[model samples]
Target: SVEELRKLLSDKDAYENYLHSIEEVKQLDTLRNDLRKRNVTLARHNLGKESEMAELRNQCMIIRTTELATAQEKFLDAQRREKEILARSSPASILNKLQEAANAADDESESLHRKLLSGELKVPEFLQKYRQQRVLYHRRTLLRLAA
Candidate 1:
């Protein structure tokens, strides 16, 4: 009877772990969807602002402000992903690795932005207004380099 009880408890633990993994995947999916929606909204806003540039002499300044806001939003999205990965990580050490990866991505994106702003790199008009795209590009480049 004791052996049977131990087996039952082990099975329960395994079942619970499986459920947790499923939940984590769902959470990650939700975060991805939300991030995509935010990106689309940012693009639409920037396009609309650019379309009115002839009438609004302040379009360039507005684009810069919007670009900053979009970058901040992308940063927040990465933060959320970092948190989710941390939560999903097992043995706990994986959380640190995931967080480090996210932070490194953020750092690379910031460096690119600084270079663009300092005129070290020439950024086209569309890129100047779309900071999230720049962040994504930088983040992917960093990840690839790390890999």
Candidate 2:
């Protein structure tokens, strides 16, 4: 009778161990499902970040292109203005015209002086003409200084 009781106790212990193993398996399956859900959420978040980055990059490229085009247009406008200025008044032609003006002023002063010396112009007339000539000369000098 004691041997029979030992056999029954041993069988009961084996059954309990099998039931514990099954519970452990169920816990492992639950943990696996939770991990799978977290992985899907992370994947979606990564995709959203990547899309935002792409849009930002496109906007940056568009801004850069517009700025470059504006700069190019401004550069072309400046070049056109420079050409117009050069065509209207080249340095050589401006210098030649200035030289001719100086020579004319000198000749006029010498002629006035000769006329006064020869009594061709009265003292009063000569003084007035001389003052006018001096004013003209001074104006020219001021213009040259300003330039």
Candidate 3:
């Protein structure tokens, strides 16, 4: 009787356990696939955001560079006008002094021009320095706009 009862119980328990194992494996496989799909989607979203951010950063730099260039150009124009006034101030009869000052300005301007043309100075920094120098010239001299 004991042996018969043991055989029946074992038969019932084995089949039920095997069925449960099969169901659990199927559920696990489905969960794995779902997680993988979500991971792929998240990765794509993050990459898109990164590229957009990079594009926006580049645009911002371009705008800032353009604004700085504009400010520098205005300052240089003012300086040139002031220099012209200074040149005109020397008595018309004293051409020699005016010529000498003009020559010096030309030499310094040429040196800076060469550096700019050669790409030795970063454009934005060069422009900023030029603006500062122009401001200094304005403050120091009796120069005024010529026209």
In terms of lDDT, the best-performing candidate is 2
Better of 1 and 3 by TM-score: 3
Clashing pairs in 2: none
Candidate 3 runs further than 4 Å off: 1-46, 91-147
Model 3 lDDT, full chain set:
0.71
**Candidate 1 CA-lDDT value:** 0.72
Ranked by lDDT from best down, the candidates are: 2, 1, 3
Q: In candidate 1, what are the lDDT values of residues 6-117, reduced to their tens digit?
A: 6657898865665557977779878999999999999999888885876676777789899999999999999999988877765455545655666665676677678788
Worst lDDT window (10 residues) for model 2? 138-147
Relative to the true structure, candidate 3 reaches a TM of 0.32
In model 3, the worst 10-residue window by lDDT is 138-147
TM-score of each: 0.26, 0.36, 0.32
Each model's lDDT comes to 0.72, 0.80, 0.71
Cα lDDT of model 2 by residue, 1-147, tens digit: 777566657898865555556977768878998999999999999997998999999999999999999999999999999998886598666655665676677678778999999989998988888777767766665665556
Error of 2 at 99 (Å): 3.4
